[model samples]
Target: MSDKDSESISDAELDRQAEVWEKIAHRPEFEKLLTAKARFIVPACVFFLVYYFALVVLVGWFPELSKKRIGPANLAYWFAFSQFFMAWIVAWIYVRAAGRFDRLSDELLGEHAQPSETPEK
Candidate 1:
């Protein structure tokens, strides 16, 4: 969406799109997508932040936890590995959720896009 693209649209078409956008804002599917994304993203962000904060605190205040050896590697190594694991898990979750979001977005666009306003290959 660019200013030039919007500028090419007639006032009536712009108004129509605005109305469509307003309706899309109220649509259950759009709302559901938002809620679902928030549910996944908020927790994931919080979990990552907490993990990061804990790591900082542990390394700063308590060095013994990171020193404890689980195998050939220490607890710090395992913690570092867990960060990578958590990142991969979040990426996987986002990729899965993105498909759902795209579907919902396409459905919304289908309801709104006029023949000319819609892109043509």
Candidate 2:
């Protein structure tokens, strides 16, 4: 085959692949997933930042809150330990939100439909 013919074939294949990808990307279910991700990510980010800053401010401004007496551990060390608890709380919140989002998307997409029954059934 001529070089031109091979180039045309490659172009056609590329176009076909692009169209398939476009369709998949534009599917309603895919769009819903994207929306759900955006919803989860934005709020989770805000919450994480707020929680982190609050922890920092509380540790800096409130000595009583950070006070600690576990052997050589200082108030800052205890406060740092509490930050892990806050991290777990944020993780739980994110997981819950993501689960809710997934459920909503599945419902919206009618993903709970059972498989088609055979004539024998």
Candidate 3:
């Protein structure tokens, strides 16, 4: 449908459409996907935050520990650099997890996903 056709849809029709979608959203398959996503995301975020702040707290509290040498660069410098690697590792892990999430989502929406003659962009 064109943008104008969509815009012309009345409030009552929109409300009815939303209600239908809301019912679908509450189905068991959708809930399972949501739970799976949350199970990975919540703990992963918490781990990242805690590790980041722990490094900050350690650096602030014990300057001597941070200043200790590891070859040329100090311990703190190594630790600081590792934070970037940590973020990248977490992102990589999430990317891997997203494959599972996408599969679950596809399974949940498979019945509702309308078949098209042409491939979607």
- Give the best candidate by lDDT: 3
Model 2 whole-model lDDT (C-alpha atoms): 0.70
**Rank order (by lDDT, best first):** 3, 1, 2
Q: Residues 76-117, candidate 2: write the lDDT tens digits.
A: 676677778978987888798888777867774475333431
How many clashing residue pairs, candidate 3?
Answer: 0
Ten residues in sequence with the least summed lDDT for candidate 1: 112-121
Query: Poorest 10 consecutive residues of model 2 by lDDT?
Result: 112-121
Candidate maximizing TM-score: 3
Clashes of each: 0, 0, 0
C-alpha RMSD of each candidate structure in angstroms: 4.0, 9.6, 4.5
Error of 2 at 81 (Å): 4.2
Can you list the residue pairs that collide in candidate 2? Answer: none
Per-residue lDDT of model 1, residues 1-121, tens digit only: 4546667779997787687567757778778778877888898889889987887787778788889999889888788788888888878988998898889788866875566654432
Candidates 1 and 3, the one with greater lDDT: 3
Better candidate number, 1 or 2, judged by lDDT: 1
